[model samples]
Target: VLCKIACMSRSRFYQSFKQKLDCTPLALQQQLRIENAAERLKAGESVSQVCFSLGYANLSHFNRRFQAQFNMPPSLYSRKNISH
Candidate 1:
Protein backbone atom coordinates (compact mmCIF):
# COMPACT_ATOMS: atom_id res chain seq x y z
CA VAL A 1 0.00 0.00 0.00
CA LEU A 2 2.75 2.43 0.94
CA CYS A 3 4.71 1.30 -2.10
CA LYS A 4 1.74 1.99 -4.26
CA ILE A 5 1.27 5.39 -2.68
CA ALA A 6 4.94 6.16 -3.15
CA CYS A 7 4.69 5.01 -6.77
CA MET A 8 7.73 2.78 -6.36
CA SER A 9 8.33 -0.90 -6.77
CA ARG A 10 8.57 -3.00 -3.60
CA SER A 11 12.34 -3.39 -3.77
CA ARG A 12 12.90 0.27 -4.57
CA PHE A 13 10.65 1.41 -1.77
CA TYR A 14 12.41 -0.82 0.70
CA GLN A 15 15.82 0.39 -0.40
CA SER A 16 14.79 4.03 -0.17
CA PHE A 17 13.10 3.56 3.17
CA LYS A 18 16.13 1.80 4.64
CA GLN A 19 18.50 4.41 3.29
CA LYS A 20 16.49 7.23 4.86
CA LEU A 21 15.44 5.64 8.18
CA ASP A 22 18.37 3.28 8.78
CA CYS A 23 15.96 0.43 9.57
CA THR A 24 13.32 -1.65 7.88
CA PRO A 25 9.73 -0.37 7.85
CA LEU A 26 8.63 -3.25 10.08
CA ALA A 27 11.28 -2.40 12.68
CA LEU A 28 10.18 1.21 12.75
CA GLN A 29 6.56 0.16 13.06
CA GLN A 30 7.35 -2.14 16.00
CA GLN A 31 9.37 0.60 17.66
CA LEU A 32 6.48 3.03 17.32
CA ARG A 33 4.01 0.49 18.72
CA ILE A 34 6.23 -0.25 21.71
CA GLU A 35 6.65 3.44 22.39
CA ASN A 36 2.90 3.93 22.27
CA ALA A 37 2.46 0.97 24.59
CA ALA A 38 4.90 2.47 27.06
CA GLU A 39 2.96 5.73 27.10
CA ARG A 40 -0.31 3.86 27.62
CA LEU A 41 1.24 1.75 30.36
CA LYS A 42 2.48 4.86 32.14
CA ALA A 43 -1.05 6.15 32.01
CA GLY A 44 -2.03 3.12 34.16
CA GLU A 45 -3.21 0.76 31.50
CA SER A 46 -2.82 -2.98 32.20
CA VAL A 47 -0.26 -5.12 30.45
CA SER A 48 -2.83 -7.37 28.79
CA GLN A 49 -4.81 -4.35 27.69
CA VAL A 50 -1.80 -2.68 26.17
CA CYS A 51 -0.69 -5.91 24.50
CA PHE A 52 -3.96 -6.75 22.83
CA SER A 53 -4.93 -3.17 22.07
CA LEU A 54 -1.73 -2.77 20.13
CA GLY A 55 -2.70 -5.83 18.02
CA TYR A 56 -0.34 -8.17 19.76
CA ALA A 57 -2.03 -11.56 19.90
CA ASN A 58 0.59 -13.20 22.16
CA LEU A 59 1.50 -11.75 25.52
CA SER A 60 4.94 -13.34 25.45
CA HIS A 61 5.70 -11.88 22.06
CA PHE A 62 4.62 -8.43 23.25
CA ASN A 63 6.77 -8.88 26.35
CA ARG A 64 9.79 -9.80 24.28
CA ARG A 65 9.38 -6.82 21.97
CA PHE A 66 8.78 -4.40 24.82
CA GLN A 67 11.77 -5.74 26.69
CA ALA A 68 13.96 -5.44 23.62
CA GLN A 69 13.05 -1.77 23.28
CA PHE A 70 12.92 -0.65 26.93
CA ASN A 71 15.21 -3.10 28.72
CA MET A 72 12.30 -4.00 31.03
CA PRO A 73 9.00 -5.80 30.87
CA PRO A 74 5.78 -3.83 30.45
CA SER A 75 4.67 -4.60 33.99
CA LEU A 76 7.89 -3.31 35.53
CA TYR A 77 7.87 -0.29 33.25
CA SER A 78 4.36 0.56 34.33
CA ARG A 79 5.29 0.09 37.98
CA LYS A 80 8.21 2.45 37.62
CA ASN A 81 6.50 5.06 35.49
CA ILE A 82 2.95 5.16 36.80
CA SER A 83 2.05 7.82 39.33
CA HIS A 84 0.99 6.59 42.74
Candidate 2:
Protein backbone atom coordinates (compact mmCIF):
# COMPACT_ATOMS: atom_id res chain seq x y z
CA VAL A 1 0.00 0.00 0.00
CA LEU A 2 1.12 3.56 -0.61
CA CYS A 3 0.73 4.45 3.04
CA LYS A 4 2.49 1.36 4.37
CA ILE A 5 5.32 1.47 1.89
CA ALA A 6 5.73 5.15 2.53
CA CYS A 7 5.98 4.31 6.23
CA MET A 8 3.40 6.69 7.61
CA SER A 9 -0.28 6.95 8.35
CA ARG A 10 -2.36 7.90 5.33
CA SER A 11 -2.66 11.52 6.36
CA ARG A 12 0.94 11.80 7.39
CA PHE A 13 2.08 10.02 4.26
CA TYR A 14 0.19 12.42 2.07
CA GLN A 15 1.55 15.37 3.98
CA SER A 16 5.09 14.05 3.92
CA PHE A 17 5.00 13.25 0.24
CA LYS A 18 3.63 16.68 -0.53
CA GLN A 19 6.43 18.35 1.36
CA LYS A 20 9.04 16.03 -0.10
CA LEU A 21 7.78 16.36 -3.64
CA ASP A 22 7.01 20.09 -3.34
CA CYS A 23 3.45 19.65 -4.51
CA THR A 24 0.09 18.13 -3.58
CA PRO A 25 -1.54 15.04 -5.09
CA LEU A 26 -3.42 17.07 -7.64
CA ALA A 27 -0.33 19.08 -8.31
CA LEU A 28 1.63 15.89 -8.80
CA GLN A 29 -1.06 14.69 -11.16
CA GLN A 30 -0.53 17.90 -13.05
CA GLN A 31 3.12 17.09 -13.34
CA LEU A 32 1.68 15.23 -16.27
CA ARG A 33 0.35 18.64 -17.26
CA ILE A 34 3.85 20.05 -16.99
CA GLU A 35 5.07 17.40 -19.40
CA ASN A 36 2.18 18.05 -21.72
CA ALA A 37 2.59 21.78 -21.34
CA ALA A 38 6.18 21.50 -22.42
CA GLU A 39 5.21 19.38 -25.38
CA ARG A 40 2.32 21.62 -26.29
CA LEU A 41 4.56 24.64 -26.05
CA LYS A 42 6.93 22.91 -28.43
CA ALA A 43 4.02 22.31 -30.77
CA GLY A 44 2.93 25.93 -30.22
CA GLU A 45 0.41 26.30 -27.43
CA SER A 46 0.40 29.82 -26.02
CA VAL A 47 1.92 30.18 -22.58
CA SER A 48 -1.24 31.63 -21.04
CA GLN A 49 -3.29 28.70 -22.24
CA VAL A 50 -0.76 26.29 -20.85
CA CYS A 51 -0.87 28.14 -17.57
CA PHE A 52 -4.62 27.79 -17.34
CA SER A 53 -4.73 24.18 -18.47
CA LEU A 54 -2.16 23.30 -15.88
CA GLY A 55 -4.51 24.72 -13.25
CA TYR A 56 -2.18 27.47 -12.25
CA ALA A 57 -4.59 29.63 -10.28
CA ASN A 58 -1.88 32.25 -10.26
CA LEU A 59 0.05 32.65 -13.48
CA SER A 60 2.94 34.37 -11.72
CA HIS A 61 3.40 31.46 -9.33
CA PHE A 62 3.36 29.04 -12.22
CA ASN A 63 5.96 31.06 -14.03
CA ARG A 64 8.12 31.37 -10.95
CA ARG A 65 8.10 27.64 -10.13
CA PHE A 66 8.59 26.64 -13.74
CA GLN A 67 11.55 28.94 -14.00
CA ALA A 68 12.92 27.67 -10.73
CA GLN A 69 12.78 24.06 -11.83
CA PHE A 70 13.93 24.48 -15.41
CA ASN A 71 16.42 27.29 -14.89
CA MET A 72 14.76 29.54 -17.45
CA PRO A 73 11.46 31.24 -17.97
CA PRO A 74 8.78 29.18 -19.71
CA SER A 75 8.96 31.52 -22.68
CA LEU A 76 12.62 30.79 -23.05
CA TYR A 77 11.96 27.09 -22.60
CA SER A 78 9.43 27.38 -25.37
CA ARG A 79 11.95 29.08 -27.62
CA LYS A 80 14.52 26.50 -26.72
CA ASN A 81 11.97 23.82 -27.46
CA ILE A 82 11.57 25.33 -30.91
CA SER A 83 15.31 25.35 -31.51
CA HIS A 84 15.86 21.82 -30.30
Candidate 1 stretches greater than 4 Å from native: none
**Per-residue lDDT of model 2, residues 1-84, tens digit only:** 688987889899889888899887767765676777788788877788888887888878878877766788789889888734
Question: Where is model 1 poorest over a 10-residue stretch in terms of lDDT?
Answer: 75-84
Error of 2 at 35 (Å): 2.5
lDDT of 2: 0.79
| Residue 57 Cα positional deviation in candidate 2, in Å, after optimal superposition | 2.0
Candidate 2 residue 38 Cα shift, in angstroms, is: 1.2
Best by lDDT: 1
For candidate 1, write residues 22-83 as lDDT tens digits. 99999999999999999999999999999999999999999999999999999999999996
Q: Write down the lDDT of every candidate, Cα atoms only.
A: 0.97, 0.79
What would the TM-scores of all predictions be? 0.96, 0.61
